[model samples]
Target chain A: GESVGLHLPTLSVQEGDNSIINCAYSNSASDYFIWYKQESGKGPQFIIDIRSNMDKRQGQRVTVLLNKTVKHLSLQIAATQPGDSAVYFCAENRNFNKFYFGSGTKLNVKP
Target chain B: GAGVSQTPSNKVTEKGKYVELRCDPISGHTALYWYRQSLGQGPEFLIYFQGTGAADDSGLPNDRFFAVRPEGSVSTLKIQRTERGDSAVYLCASSPLAGTDTQYFGPGTRLTVL
Candidate 1:
């Protein structure tokens, strides 16, 4: 079945450094993508989103890049902080209603 | 001004038992969704309710899984003949009417089948 997946299971970065998480999706029909952050004992929280029509979208210290040709998406976070340590996942909207999520990448920000 | 909320933060059941999970979506949100998350993995879509009706139920694993939203506010997910494989965190989310809107997720109900 068509699904989304992350390139790495874990990533470690310094507090002041920038972090980049990668995701690859197999569904070409997907038109929307989103990044979510899940902390310990909490549900997934919305981070940022991008549509197929656009290549990149930016939010507060976060950026989502979409590459439809390669079926890849990435989330970039600048100036990583302790509070940013969590599991990050990429989700794609293929059927226009339901979202399929990736396994997830654990982001660990070192002090 | 509250976010999505789910009842019985944690549930423990034995095989062959039945269980019901509840979800309360954000106020005024017209779209509700249910998902299942296993250990070390992301959420998998199960069903979606647009208002009081189910718009999509393609993600439901089998007939043992069922859900309903009568008043378009509180939704319940019922599981029958539970198996050990059913142990997972069931998540609920809500969004605006638009399909592409950002979804706000609840804390989730952790179900453990013993």
Candidate 2:
């Protein structure tokens, strides 16, 4: 089975506001989770990541949360800007050897 | 180079034709992976090579798809008798080692099977 998926296909946020994108994973054994941002016609760019041992991790203006019990993950962006508009993807990493990427959510920042 | 690279950015071929996608990983990276992504979908795993041997080929969809990383630096994904359903963006990634989850990805090769 595929490991990760998103509940929302598209999200819009007012510029300067905060944005949150949610993801659900099927694999209970996945220990590491990562969030990526991909612009049009470009590959995914790493945003932030969190391990199973930590519930949350922060990087720049992005934050990642991991819930082991629910197998859920989320990426939060503070002070969202117009430049933040892109497709957001969440990936699951298990066994530290394999990764499964989730269907991305397109986030639009309204100016 | 410091980043992964893929060649033949776009390819158009008829059904039953053969195709090969190439990838060059970052210098000294030992783990290379292949993935396929269709329109409006996430990338799907295909195969992985650690050093000269494939460590995981379980994700390969069928026997028609084959990949090789002979020297552990440059890798190739080969498809035979390509079908329309085989059209996708072939992506390649490389990590320092298989044990590290952080992988750097290339721009990918867009394959169109008609």
Candidate 3:
């Protein structure tokens, strides 16, 4: 069964600290991955994305790292803030058509 | 500059009833998608549409689920004989193109099957 899963279901981080969320995907054919943040009552917002050709991609205060060898992916948020407290998800895109999402990791930021 | 929008933010219906969920994509977006999210779980892909035609519907769970994207801008997800398990948030997303693009999502429609 092809699936994407997270290593941790919940992560609690103090405000101003860095936070890392991990995910493992089973499909080798997946070439693209994205991280999304969802707040209560709102839709999932795109944080960042990385292609298979790149090992690391960085954005403002955020970074996505892909490890094709181990079939793993990670999203790192620098200087986590209270507003960053939300459920984080990692999605894998296959054949450039469909995306498979993992059960999210709830990030609780303590102010 | 409006993002994707879904109508009837919430719906409560009895089992075996039919329901329709609507989605309005961002202007100029050609790709549309439907997803279902269970409590504490991530969104599950249901279908994808390119322009006015369905490009891929293999993710749909069963014959009870169907979707249409007419005129290439709006889409409706239809569910027939809904079951209790159908209770979930229905999410709609659209991208400028079919693949490798950022998908803008709408505040999902929450369906409760009683």
Candidate 4:
């Protein structure tokens, strides 16, 4: 079945440095994409989202980039903080029905 | 404004037992969704409701799993004859509307089937 997947399982970055997590999705029909952050024992928290019509979207210290042609998505966190340590997931939505999530990438910010 | 909320943050059940997980979505949101997250994996779609009717349920694994939103504000996910594989974090989310809306998630209900 077509699904969303991440390029790496874990990413470690030093505090105050930039961090980028990558994801790959197989469904071309997907038009909306979102990035979520989940800490231990917590549900996913919405970070940022982007539409297929746009290539990039930015929020507070976070940016989401989408490449429809390559079926790729990326989340960039500026000046990574220790509080940013968590599992990040990318979700793709098609036709506003359901969203498929990737396995997730664990971001470890070293203090 | 309150965010999504799920009851009984954690549950432990034996095999073949029945369990129900509840979700209270954000006020005035018409779209609700449920997902299951297993260990080392992201959340997997289970079902979605547009108002009081199920708009999509293709993600449900089998017949034993069912969900309902009677008044379109709250939803309950029922699992009959639960199996060990059913153990996971059940997450509920809600969006203001269907198309291009961002979903806000609950704290989740972690169910452990032994």
Candidate 5:
């Protein structure tokens, strides 16, 4: 079956250190992608997004990199904070309707 | 004035029982979507609505699940004969327009079938 997956299931980083979470998607037909963060008991919150035409997009403290050639997507957080510790997911949209999700990477920021 | 809102923060039902979850989207948002998230996994798309009509329902697992949006605003997802496997968090999201619009998500309803 077609799917998206994360390279690391869990990652721990020191506060103020940078963090990078990687995802690999098998669907080349997907054109739109979004990143979301979810707390333990909450719904996924919108973080950032990138289109297939572009390779990168940045938000307040997060950056999304899309590698079309390798079918890879990554989310980078600058100066990781305790608030940034959450499960990060990469979702790809087809025809802008259905969104296929990666398993997700759990981020843990240690002080 | 608010983000998405879902009713019944938590639900506990026995196996083979029925459950209904509701979602209230943001004002002026025409696109609505439903997704299911299991423990340690990201959300999986279950369905999407464009206005009062369901535009894509292919993500639904089986005929046991159904949803409706008669007025294109509030939506309800109903599951019949829920099993233990149905235990998960049901998430609702809404977008202003179609095609890749930024989605605002609700806190979600946690359904537990035992």
Candidate 6:
């Protein structure tokens, strides 16, 4: 089945440094994409989102970039903080309400 | 100002028994969704509700799994004849609308089937 996938299972970054998490999706029909962060024992928290019509979207200290030509998406966190340590997931919205999520990338911010 | 809320933070049940998980979405949100997250994996879509109607339910795994939203505000996910494989975290989320709105999630209900 077509699904979303991550390029890396884990990412470690030093505090105050930048972090980038990558994801790939196989479905071309997907038009909306979102990045979510989940800490231990918690549900995913919405970080940022981008539409297929746009290439980049930024919010707070996070930025989401979409490359429809390559079916790729990336989340960049500026000045990563220890609190940012968590698993990050990329999801593609399809069929209006249905969402396809990647396995997730664990981001470890070293303090 | 409150976010999504789920009941029974943790549920332990024996195989072949029945279990029900509840979700209270954010106030005034018209779209609700359910997902299941297994160990070392991401949340998998289960079902979706819009204004008391199941707008999409193709994500439901099998006949034993069912969900209902009677008044478009709250929902319950029912699992009949639960199996060990059904053990996972059930997450509920709600958005202002269905398609492009941001979905806010609940703390989730962790179910363990023994």
lDDT of each: 0.96, 0.90, 0.96, 0.95, 0.94, 0.95
Of 3 and 4, the candidate ahead on DockQ is 3
Tell me what fraction of the real C-alpha contacts between chains A and B each candidate also makes: 0.81, 0.47, 0.81, 0.83, 0.85, 0.77
For candidate 4, write residues B1-114 as lDDT tens digits: 899999989999999999999999999999999999999999998999999999989999999999999999999999999999999999999999976799999999999999
Which number leads on DockQ? Answer: 3
Encode model 5's per-residue lDDT on A39-62: one tens digit a residue: 888888999999999999998888
Candidate 4 wrong stretches, greater than 4 Å: none
Q: For residues A1-111, what per-residue lDDT tens digits would candidate 6 score against the true structure?
A: 898999999999999999999999989999999999999999999999999999999999999999999999999999999999999999998776788899999999999
Give the Å shift of residue B63 in candidate 4: 1.2
Q: Per-residue lDDT for B7-64 in model 1, tens only?
A: 8899999999999999999999999999999999999999999999999999899999
lDDT of 3 by residue, A1-111 (tens): 989999999999999999999999999989999999999999999999999999999999999999999999999999999999999999999968789999999999999
Question: Model 4 — interface RMS deviation?
Answer: 0.9
lDDT of 2 by residue, A1-111 (tens): 645899999999999999999999988878888788888777777788888899999989988988888889999999999999999999888766778888899999999
All DockQ scores? 0.85, 0.68, 0.87, 0.85, 0.84, 0.85
- How high is each candidate's TM-score? 0.98, 0.96, 0.98, 0.98, 0.97, 0.98
What shift in Å separates residue B86 of candidate 3 from its native position after superposition?
0.5
Give the CAPRI class of candidate 4: high
Residue A31 of model 5 has an lDDT of: 94
As for candidate 3, its clashing pairs are: none
TM-score, candidate 5, is 0.97
lDDT of 4 by residue, A31-66 (tens): 999999999999999999998999999999999999
In model 1 chain A, which range of ten residues has the least summed lDDT? A91-100
DockQ of 1: 0.85
Better of 1 and 5 by lDDT: 1
Query: How many clashing residue pairs appear in each of the predictions shown?
Result: 0, 0, 0, 0, 0, 0
State which docking tier applies to candidate 6. Answer: high
Tell me the tens digit of each residue's lDDT in model 1 across A12-111. Answer: 9999899999999998899999999999899999999999999999999999999999999999999999999999999999888888899999999999
Q: Which ten residues in a row are the worst by lDDT in model 4 chain B?
A: B95-104
